[model samples]
Target chain A: MPRFILTFTLLVVLSAGGCSPSNEQDKLTVVVAASAQFAFRDIAEEFSKNNNVAVDIITGSSGKLTTQILYGAPYDILVSANMHYVEVLENSEKTHGEPFVYGCGVPIVWTMNAEFDLDSIASYFCLPDVERIAIADPKNAPYGEVAVKYLKSLGIYEKVKGKLVFGESISQVNEYVLNKTVDVGITAKSIVASPKLKGKGFYRELGEDFYIDQGMALINTKTTHDLKTKFKAFVQSEEGVNILESYGYKLSK
Target chain B: MIDLSPIWLSLKLALLTSCLLLIIGLPIAYALSQWKSRLKVVVESFVSLPIILPPTVIGFYLLIMFSPENAFGKMLGDAGIQIPFTFTGILLASFIYSFPFMVQPIQKGIESVPDHYKNISYTLGKSKFETFMRIILPNIKRSVITGFVLTFAHTMGEFGVILMIGGNIPGETKVASLAIYSDIEALNYSAAHTYSIILLGISVVIIIALNMLNAKKRR
Candidate 1:
């Protein structure tokens, strides 16, 4: 009876050690840009449905993600909103190889109230009643840079200087407009396309000159598995382009 | 040198929030100390909810509830009182975020007060309200100060809620924490470091002062 109990305890310990799920799933961790969260989620779900592998996707600003990767964040794949961040990682020897342009991002002017006309919204910058304008911080966010460029193109950069309220990310900018915390906001076209902000705000597409060619890269130095290679191929495939296009993002051929 | 506006805003927010929290938290805490019911336990749990929940979760709820299209938000808008992205919004968020910091200490202090003091005041023809103000309150003054210091310090370091609700508008909603986050986001590590060190120095000074005061009181 004592022998049987000892054997049972050994079996339990072995089973517990052998079936630790977190360690088993370590190879599947993929960090992408915050803007690509929904798209990556869809793709990751589809990928996981056929395969036994689990994917842990962490999302944040491209620059922040790059910083984290440099600081030894356990990230396998990095889908950025701009090539500059990926380039920074590559230049710093943090990435495996050169980055690839996956999709292009475009900026849009969004507003919450129906009181603002979409066509005449550009002129609203000159209006005294327009107290606040929301945009992501240009220094780190790609969409913010485009927004600033668009404002400059319209010669309203100085006019809207004082009223400009900055969000940490593109989603926050959308939230600011949706909440009516700001009179108007500049965010990505994909965010404007979201059903959550559909009726809450009006949007105008900025010109292609204001668009950014977003890129993705695999950090080969850190990942022990072939996750970087697999993810890179998957993202560059036609399937990924379809997902990107569905979200109002233009894919680069 | 650092941009002083955000620091000033943070200090103002901390001061106002601590004052408001003390006013609201004191009575609730006093009542909670006297009560020993199942409902009291539930209320106590609710009071500490902010401390347990993530700041972003609180900010999300605050954003929806205080948005101009929502019921409360619309009412405020109709009344010419806007909350979101304003100084008032920062104060409201800070107050909610630091509520338990104000309540828990005060509750413990009130609970520690001897029942003899209240009984004597009652026997001396003092009303319940008068006894609470003159007797119970004075005895728990240390806890009240501790609560204020804690709430103020927590408000000074507030980030997630203010970032979500206030939208980081300069001279309005942008506080020191948000400024630090912005500087970090911008890769301006030097500025971020400067602001962070200053904030750290201020917090350390406040905490040391409070500890010294507490030690003196004990002696």
Candidate 2:
């Protein structure tokens, strides 16, 4: 019985190895900011189907992704939440060439609270019922940075600073927002508009003045495959723009 | 210069967690040591669950439980007792995550007291509380210290639970571990290095001190 089991395991392993080469050249690895995760997933899927290339999408805060790239993580492309991180990567000579604006993300005030006054976003923070407000960590998340800027512009940054909680990324902020752990959160519109979270909560756009210009760039590496270029082109293509638009992103082009 | 607040915050958290655990864990450990029921096994398992479970698991559940959307959380919220994103929240998290570290050692210490010493005290008309305080506690000095130090160090190194619930608020929840994480994420390598070295130094000193104490006890 043991010998038969061993033979069966050996046959299975051999068949798995026989079906696909260990190092497939047509595979592309794309790292994206957490806020753009859902939109990029669809873009990658469509690109994969059209080009017959496998695409792997990794999601993280733009700053974290840039740090990984700086440390030479094997990623083919980066879809940053803002232009700043892409510029940082470019300054560090981590990119193939100049980065391009892929989309512009609108920041939004999102809440699960039925009694939340969306119109009085500035005043809402001072309310007794609203105890905690979540935002992405401004240090690394562009959405968080913009949120802070928005508050500061309204001259209420200091007043509401005490109630703020910083999530590591926009995705973490979404977790707080959707779970209703926080009374409200400042996050990318793409997040609340994404199919999974759509209609689950109330979201008010923070206006075009608070938009973040999302950036994309190919990583410079010895393993840079043609599929990487094809993937980048596909993201800027009309189909990709439509997907981004559906997710509440405005096309820069 | 890198902010020294995170290091201080970590030390504060560790000190508070160990101190709080000492107060809470002593009675529980003592009770367990005297307990001989079949259910004791189940109780011990639950106490030790934090040690076995990943911090993220604890963090996730704690996050849910603290959210106002949950019934229990709403009750606390109504009472104006908020937990999420506050220093108090992280303190509670550290207490749970470091429960076994504080409990197990002291429990063993109590159990190691020969059955007769406790009986002798009881026979002499000493109350049960007095007997535990004077006889059992005095004998288990080593285990008590071990439990305290272990919990302190463990809480200092706590990351996942605090991350999920802490909200990375400066001067509140941004202890050394989370500070190091945020620094690395922001590509502030120098700040990250400074925090890492300090933590590494503190951790090594604690382990060495613990070993010396144990060695002296053995002697």
Candidate 3:
């Protein structure tokens, strides 16, 4: 028992020993919305290469990320899928400065099945063979909200309501579509357009008019870090914009 | 104000899981209690795996196994049996997740029933099934209740597995725990609080009632 205790204590100490101040100071941790995951991965890599800094990107629903920010998550910046979460962080006085819109996200219907018709999302969803449809949870995810709105606008929400399944975030919706867990999924166009997922599935854009304006803000209100500032600027830079555009994000300006 | 549908869904799931576990656990528990072999240890450990393993493991396995792209899932799909993102999917997940809670106690209870009781029943010309239903079952009443209550409450506390496969469909797979989680993420604290308070109240009531019943049985 004494030997076991010593081994356990040693393991715990070894696991918790990674907090060197120099490394911590040099690293920039950014929390990104799930919809922007693929785009941000490329952006983070480019920014890290250009600035010679290690950049960490954590991804989840914007609302979930905002809650973490509010509760003192150590993320240096948040790239949200919408401005609503950014505003929530701002209202809580957790922001280093005013939130800014970085890009716009367009929703798309995606499917891994090659035989499934994708021209008309509404009619396709109403089919008897399309048993399960995946969507992000509209209560927290902006992409999910847009998907619900799109379905409602087409007057097929009630008709196809029983087939809908809610993923906690658009990333999960992408997973469902990629893995063929659901017949199809409503997700951000950026997902299917990502280099890793591009051409792996079929996708139909739900028009450019219905788009979510994404937001970005620094969370370290006390003292803004240089790397965080550089990252923010890098995301808005021409190279970053190009990378995002490659992943199907629309620039507002 | 809160939507009570999630709470009702949770109760319905828990009730069904509890009843189903009871029907399924009894024979296995009995068999395990009577068995005396090296393989019994392996089977017992497998039954108890969920207690130690994280719910996400089960969720991931369920997702992969039931995906329409997989052979097993495709076979089921061909038969028009859908599992993922449905109430039935979550129910099957819950059964695997809460199996140990329903089985272990009943096995212990069956083991505690002395050999003389069964021997006497057999001498009286009672069949093995009759002996188990009358002689053995009566002796393990407390164990059965413990197993039932634990399974019911454990099912209520299930979040990770449900979150992985539930798809958060209202009045279907969206249970109270998932609702509270969504409410918190959406920053609807009031609704989260209401659902939490009710879940807490019910859990406390169940545990207290269970303790009282156990104490009375002891007396």
Candidate 4:
């Protein structure tokens, strides 16, 4: 009975491998941090139009994606909001090589309320109607860690801790802030620069002191597939930096 | 990736919820069963609403009510008490979420009992409370146990309401279900599997116990 079962399993595996089609080869999957989603989508769309490969971008909290990759999730590239996750993966030999910095992540305090004043941003927590403050989950998202750091830097994290609501991702934080569930949200500057979200809220950027860089990495040496390599080359090209800059990413300085 | 804290948290939450529901549910169920007023229908509808109302609906409103800017929350705040993102918050959400589960079964049992038992005990010089303890209590023992077990299992599997009210703070409010979700999100499938199996096993055992108790009563 065991022998028969093993033969059947072998047959199924071999047949499945043989039946795989060319469309699978025509695709490249890139996992991205939620904060870099909009710009990466733009890059993927542009890349796919010129090249015949289907560029699939998966976005989530960078830490969560790193955990996934470490557990052997299939992906061609990983773009993280924090270079730290990439560095960990590279050290663990999960990536082809050391990750390259693509852009600096900028933090911002955004409010969808038109009546709110951005002048005294540090003291905005004391505003009478400022009830909930939404930030990404600091344990998993880089923007969340920066939000916590920035709040502590301003010396108000303790006072405002009670009002804080943590979203699972920066995208979720944006939703909570935009829908007025939270009076203030800490989000990425890239999100605010997106055309759909621009001008709907007041935003003040956290300066150079709070800046962190986004890192892009080719997954593993086995990801040496031509299409994946081409995509990596295209992103590192000067035009790719320009595209990132247009989307509010500071390539350098 | 794997932590027994979620299991312990879930057990603690379920235990507290079931015990509190028993104490809190009895009076409400008795009042609902014995009330002679026309508006009792209105009150009963309010009690039964949680059973039909989606967890998300209750969670959304509870989240709003618990917000510091809101009136109810402000009242709690003035007392130097906070509800959201605390163990107390989970306790409160569980009480409300599992109230109907505990109350409905007992209420049905109380409502079905004839007036003669109470009347007969009352004529023998027993007070209302004494007659309730002596007569009504024993008659409805099976239903009360069912209510407790049902509430226990229901609270164990509770996810959405916990998500909205509890906010997944580890050790404080991250119960087993949310822990499983966090595990899977982080791609820790093994931990997720372990948590899921534990929940599934415990729920089936509790439910089977409930069915056996009910079946014994029927026999």
Best by TM-score: 3
Q: Can you tell me which runs of candidate 2 are displaced by over 4 Å?
A: A1-25, B1-219
* Tens-digit per-residue lDDT, B23-69, candidate 3: 89989999999999999999999999999989988986887788665
After TM-score superposition, the amount by which residue B148's alpha carbon in candidate 1 deviates from its true location, in angstroms, is 19
TM-scores for all predictions: 0.52, 0.53, 0.55, 0.52
Chain B TM-score, candidate 2?
0.98
Residue A41 miss distance in model 4 (angstroms): 25
Candidate 3 clashing pairs, residues 3+ apart or interchain: none
Query: Which candidate number maximizes lDDT?
Result: 2
* Candidate 2, A179-234: lDDT as tens digits: 78899999988877778777987889988899888999889865555667778788
Better of 2 and 4 by lDDT: 2
Positional deviation of residue B97's Cα in model 2 after best superposition, in angstroms: 19
Q: Worst lDDT window (10 residues) for model 3 chain B?
A: B181-190
Q: Give each candidate's fraction of reference contacts reproduced.
A: 0.00, 0.00, 0.00, 0.00
| Overall lDDT per candidate, in order of appearance | 0.76, 0.83, 0.82, 0.80
TM for candidate 3 is: 0.55
List A-chain TM-scores for all predictions: 0.85, 0.90, 0.92, 0.88
Tens-digit lDDT string for candidate 1 (B110-142): 999989999999999999999988888888878
The count of backbone overlaps in candidate 4 is 0
Standalone chain B TM-score for every prediction: 0.96, 0.98, 0.98, 0.95
Q: For residues A72-133, what per-residue lDDT tens digits would candidate 1 score against the true structure? A: 44467788888899999898787777888888887788887677777776688768889999
